[model samples]
Target: MSNSPTLGYLIPQFPGQTHIFFWREILALERMGINVALFSTRPPPPGLISHVWSDEAMKRTEYLGNMDPRRAAKATLGVSPALWAKDVLREGRVLAKDLAIASAAAQKLKESCAARGIQHVHAHSCARSALVALLAQQLGGPTYSLTLHGPLSDYGPGQRLKWRHAKFATVITEKLRKELPELLGEDQPEKIFVQPMGVDVNALIRDVPYHPHQSPQQLRIFACGRLNIVKGHQDLMAAIRLLRDKGIDVRLDIAGEDDDGGSGYRKELENRITELDLQDHVALLGAISAEEVRRYLLSAHVFTLASWHEPLGVAYMEAMSCEVPTIGTNAGGVPELIRDGIDGLLVEPKSPDALANAIMLLARNPKDAQRLGQAGRTRIIERFNCEKGAELIAREALDLRVSEEI
Candidate 1:
């Protein structure tokens, strides 16, 4: 530790499954000799911290949402009442709860960061995490920034407040970049920069034994993600039905955890498979390890996810990194990653025919599949490499530190 300050990460979930990019960025920044402290508002959801990397993060993180009575009292007394009330007013009703308590606990967060000599804070999500940043700033803490991750639909009310004093707001994709002005007002153009969630393309794809062209007698199609309606798993199942109807002898492997123990949408997927009489053809391999996911990707003939609202899918990136000829909808940030008919294939959202056609085309033509898959790996390496994204972010953070000097 020199005379400089550490960076603080204010996040809702520290070791979340969908937040692997955050960990990668943190690790990369650490490897670059930057000190980062994790301040999570909530502990991770059940089963989200299974990975060894996540366990390491959990050890370093402090959960503000779980403060003890004496600590809470000290935190409460540390906040200036006027400042807390001001933040509550600025945050309004939607974020008032998050802002109020976190603002009151601002001293606790500040004390933790201050102990590490952290000067600037970067939050992961715009809503809860950014609100914490805003409130912490109000309490005379770190100068804070935020990343706008998804569509600003649920975050409209809160984001505008966050942007008013945020050091900068990084968009997770170009799609969100275009909407920054519309979502955060027309004046926020200068505050926004597109930064997609990155994957370690080289590490993920390197030297994985490739699945040789499978016989038409057995085609294994793989999709891994949260089993939910928004991911369009049902539509994916419909595509499987199309492939089976044509007697393509395709087998689908769906690896993911249900939101509510196979009760809601996961049940729907299982019922749909049963309804199509394709139960034997489709296997729902629930929630495998990250290594297992990599294995599945490397071994599969095709990787497909027909999501309707993918802001950007790390799953798609991972699949492409493994050089599995991938299929994704023209949804959200997917178009930015996949150049349809060039690197991989893109189908219309919820269009089983297009997805099925893409699957069949790749299945019958192994040479084309290999060609597209290799292109995808090259594209990921050049464009979406995790180290590159982390370097850009670290540059921006250092730039902000110099400019803000707080």
Candidate 2:
């Protein structure tokens, strides 16, 4: 390997079902000549490594939960007292528990990165992982940066705190980037660049090419996300009910795992499925692999996720890349990803009527639907491909490494 400065990636979790975009970015970065060391602040899911990509990731990842307790204690105390106090005062009462755990993990993660010759550490999110990066910088390991993907307000006062310490930061949407100064409560928040997450568009098209629309067939619809309230699976069920009531035959395949967030929600989704008597029309494929998701994307007449307050979703692009027309709520970065009438449709969040209407509109107009699918695939290729997105962020990381050194 070339002896360039190594870049370390710190995430709150490593290789979960929804993080395929991240893994794609990591692969692209590696191809672009960056040696990346991965660190995780969360515990691995039960069964330990379900997907091939995740299994490969697990082999190289460092988990905070896996560190020895004695070593963790020693590292916790190893931080300079002044720096620890600064974080406490900076976070105040809100992030005490998170701050403490992240601080300890940062020190341990720093040691891991050092052994691997990592010169810069980066994390995705303004919360725990970013906190770990900030703490690692304090422990004199490596300078760090972060990428903000969601509502900064959700990160609480910690968002502002991370901004102050991160050597640089990235936001996934133009709206988020434009609002960075307000979000960070800091001047020159332009230092926090706009770099959206994405998938390997070319690979997707090659592996799962657009199947030409066959003559009048029952529509196959697919939705994917964690089985939780914010994902709006219930609302989707309601829309499906409306479709069936209207005699517009459709089959909905909802693919996602119900982790901690799915406990009661998954059961509720099942209840709704039975109540709607959509047993034949809908199937809940719990926790499918990425390849399975691609199959659904390619097979489906249209793909959609009616998420509430979602940050940019990778699934939308994955579907569109396969020339599958997609739909999403006009929430967060969805609008940025989908052109309302051109590529994919956008509906109001939490409104099953609007969702059902959009589905019906597409269902009735097969030619328009195919046209939209084609446009969506073209959009992913022209703008949202993994290498293009990855190259931008990788450039930022490389520049940050040099700037910090200077």
Candidate 3:
């Protein structure tokens, strides 16, 4: 334990999903007495060993600040360019922003690691954070690694840059690992590792025996994710409306932030809910903390996420750990976790009718819902606990360093 290596964690921003994953990994490493220091463009909260740079650096490195002008230019370039040009134009805006953030974050990370004697740097995502970690490694000579979460929209132009520069990369699902080599080339395949995003399964698993809601008169259905176009919340809302039209008395609670790529999708969702007269039946509880989210799961009969394309649904795992029946779109890594109709239901992505039908099927059949929830909880305990995930990542981080040295 005393001989374990020290690591520096780098990110463009902290206190979000990336922060959660990085912090959990840090805690896991710390359990073996490995030390971690975090460096970010945005300041981290107290209790995390964080290094914050000046406000000027933040302004220059922010994604929004760097993206707008480039995105506007790309939009003006029109869509008729060559396929490569079109792909570059489409992904260029994000790449520009990530590169800018990484450039600035790298300088800060270099200074921090040099001062702290950190051995390796691991970034939470493969975009800006990975760029920062890579550049910082070049500056400080510490080996760098990255963890890739889903939604490739964030990687854009800088994806290749980060992949080539990182000592190794960890992805949350095998689906992502399969896609990486194609994007980064076969030569870099050895640098990619598949590790699922994990939760504290023991803490989250239902301690007591399964108990159905005493009153079966009212059914509670839950869905969560950033409320946006890709999340298919609009489809879920439409499905809920269809169920209501058919005289199915059900309640839905949707939790998450409303800012999804600035499309005003959240407002549209609210308007549709109003138009359908579902104000009383649907509740929009925006962006609750993870602990609060657990409480919401405990209170609900079923948990659902209808995202059109999810890389790996961590919220689904969290809900499953809480013994709640789950349903998700059959896109991305969702099918990897859910054994359709066994552990939970898997409906066609972006189909409101399919989502509605699935919800109604579970709502009417409480016994099946209970069985699914129990099965899901059991599955999560066996595979996706934080302790197991951390062990794997920590081992990989150390291995990456050793391999680089060799």
Best by TM-score: 2
Best-to-worst ranking by lDDT: 2, 1, 3
| Number of backbone collisions per candidate | 0, 0, 0
Cα lDDT tens digits, model 2, 52-165, are 677788788878755466655766776665654665686686676766667667778777777887778888777778777877777777878888888777775566656776
CA deviation > 4 Å runs, candidate 3: 1-4, 17-19, 43-101, 151-153, 186-189, 207-209, 212-216, 260-264, 399-406
Assess candidate 3 and give its lDDT.
0.68
Runs of candidate 2 with Cα error greater than 4 angstroms are 2-4, 47-50, 66-87, 187-190, 206-216, 400-406
| TM match of model 1 to true structure | 0.89
Error of 1 at 337 (Å): 1.4
Cα lDDT of model 3 by residue, 162-215, tens digit: 666567777888887777656766436255767787777755766555555434
Instruction: Provide C-alpha RMSD values for all models, in order.
Output: 3.5, 3.2, 7.7
Best candidate, lDDT: 2
- Candidates 1 and 3 compared: the better one by lDDT is 1
TM-score per model over all chains: 0.89, 0.91, 0.81
lDDT of 1 by residue, 260-333 (tens): 53455777888888998898899888766677788788779899999998988888888888899999999888
